[model samples]
Target: MISRRAASPKRSTPRLPHLAGSAFRSRSASPLALNVMTIITRFLSLAVLTLHCVAFAAGCTADETSTTTTLSTSSSADASESTKESRVLRHAVFFSFKESSSPEEIDAVAKAFEQLPSKIDSIVDFDWGVNNSPEGLDDGFTHCFLLSFADEAGRAEYLPHPAHKEFGDTLRPHMEDVFVIDYWGDANEVTDAKSDDETELKHAVFFKFKDDASEEDVAKVEQAFAELPNKIDSITDFEWGTNNSPEKHDDGFTHCFMVTFADEAGRETYLPHPDHEAFVELLKPVLDKARVLDFTTK
Candidate 1:
């Protein structure tokens, strides 16, 4: 009786949906729906990888730009520091007022001259004082002004400046004579001498060599003068150079020697020192005119 119904048609079970070669099977999804979801997941992963690569590349570029800028800034600072350390141009000016100029007028002229440094940008250093040399070799020059510049360009700019031109106008009527000498010198020479607590006395000497003097004679004189600092204990600092001014105001002076002393006693001892006298003996024959100006720095 049970085998009798077995002849009826047999039925097969339905298969679950799954991706090709996948172990997982889903009962709720169709094959077409699973294919779409797999495609979307793969595309999202690729998109995330692309975003990470772009962010990394941008970071590298930013770092490189920052490094280059830092290097450029460092180089400029080093060059500026080196220039400040090496040397500076010196502008030494001396003035003598006319006999007709009263003290008040002379003082006004000096005040006006002093203000130019503030008004002119190229004047780096400034100092001035009245002559107090007991040696009486000033050649009627009563006032001395010392100014400094970084280089020739700075001086060039200062020379034609409106402030300097105005100052010249104020000085012309009262000025009897003007002497200017420009030279390049070590930056630390004057600064080191001035660092001391004692008051400084500057002995500035200018000489116009005789027309007949030989170059060898001039060299000997320069060497002998240079040796005075080594021989004389009273000389605090010493420097010398030939005039290189563009203004043609040296008044026939060629060589300028600057000697610094700590006090009046130091200068007094230096003036009559045996070594100085010996140098003077060597200098007199070749020297045509010597102008000496001594002042206590203010």
Candidate 2:
């Protein structure tokens, strides 16, 4: 695979996460509107590591079949440069409840979050998630979602997506408390994240290697690192890859990875798994240079 530079980080908000009702008990919306936003603020408090993905973008440019199956597994950041900035920013939606809800209820909300894709607005990207921790995060909430749009107008249209509002109404009875936090994020801050909190889950991470690393050699390192997720069950979502081009760098930096867990414990479980230990061993050899960044959404 030919290497291309990584794409620039477009300033965007984080997506709200969606957890499965089956995953945990649902919390009722708290009496305080600010309570929901506060939790998200706590999440934004974590850094979101951006992996340079111009190479991943190049990889994505291949034929249709490869794009979905092969490229999905590509190692490193998958950011694409987005220009024509407008009122819309990347939207990160993070919410948690008090307990687990039924699968049907979970599906209802999942569908609500899903409506943004074709909500008749300027939206161009959307993704959602369910909390996957095995237990311990006794909180009633169970999901988080991240949605991206071309501009703020797209976001405005989304608020009343009739469908989304319906989702809130549908979730009202099953929910104990709903939390939300919205942040205006920049690519530079995301890629160069730092943090002091050891309890929250890490968002984005950055790494840079010398210019001499050939595309094939880079591919080998990724192949070895990709298997890290296989080690355990606590990992809710895992995405890791490298920056394709040096030219795309906001700085000379070039690679990064991101992992999301149900809570801090899920992340902690994955850290010591035997397979993860091996992954560290494999990565250390190819890692001529590296840096680890961790952050939350707050």
Candidate 3:
């Protein structure tokens, strides 16, 4: 759980924030206290991963784009241009990290990144993560994440902010490899916001499991997600599934699950829940290469 509000300064030896919030704020780490090194690390992670997703999707064959155009009829490239104009994907950075990263290391990395992740103005939804796995594949990157905003300008504002750049400077040396991609969230895509009593805090967690898992594995995972909504008092919504990305975009990810809450406060409530605890126990056996990204988005 990361949020902002602090002085601008670097520590001779940086320490990441340990949190405890109001559901959203871990009771431990409240609003914020600057940890320059952590911010730099998250920024670097964000940019490198962002580029990775774009690079991966950029592989979609132009021929596929052409083939999708009605084979029934098409005279020139002009008609294709028109279709391309009608659909554009808003891009976000997704990073996959080494599987062996310790919880302390991951938490340390997440903590240093204490910047405000907002869904303000213009167009899309924004998010970021730690990878979960049942082992085997690791091309060095495994922590998949999502980034969204109102529109391109909103993202542009985020790209070169002092906070972002500082992160890039710090993370380059320690990183092994990274990937990023971009996509759009259509304004037409309708999602019903939960009612008022639920508005004070809102959060979503998205994760996908390995594609080759058995049916039983998936069922176990769903049970885990389902039990989360019940085990925690604050959860208002919970859903799970396999991803429906255009086979072209899904790479290594397959099964997906998401849970939403009024805010971080309610979200934190689940962290220590017993069902969530038991589910965690059940999960280790059936899950594979799982990825988790938690964020505040509407």
Per-candidate TM equals 0.69, 0.34, 0.36
The digit string of per-residue lDDT tens for model 1 on 159-183 reads 9999999999999999999999998
Error of 2 at 110 (Å): 1.6
lDDT of 2 at 86: 23
Off by over 4 Å in 2: 1-88, 97-101, 133-140, 185-298
Give the runs in model 3 whose Cα sits over 4 Å from its true position.
1-212, 247-251
Candidate structures ordered by TM-score, highest first: 1, 3, 2
| Candidate 2 per-residue lDDT over residues 2-118, each given as its tens digit | 234335555577654354552123354344645766666666654332233555666657666676666665532232224233222445444444356676876776676677566
Clashes of each: 0, 79, 49
Query: Looking at candidate 1, what is the lDDT of residue 170?
Result: 95
- lDDT for position 102 in model 3: 63
lDDT of each: 0.87, 0.52, 0.51
| lDDT tens digits, residue span 203-291, model 3 | 32334455566887877677667777656888766544444333244445554455656666775676677777788787776556544
Question: Where does model 1 exceed 4 Å of error?
Answer: 1-85, 189-198
Model 1 is weakest, by summed lDDT over 10 consecutive residues, at 189-198
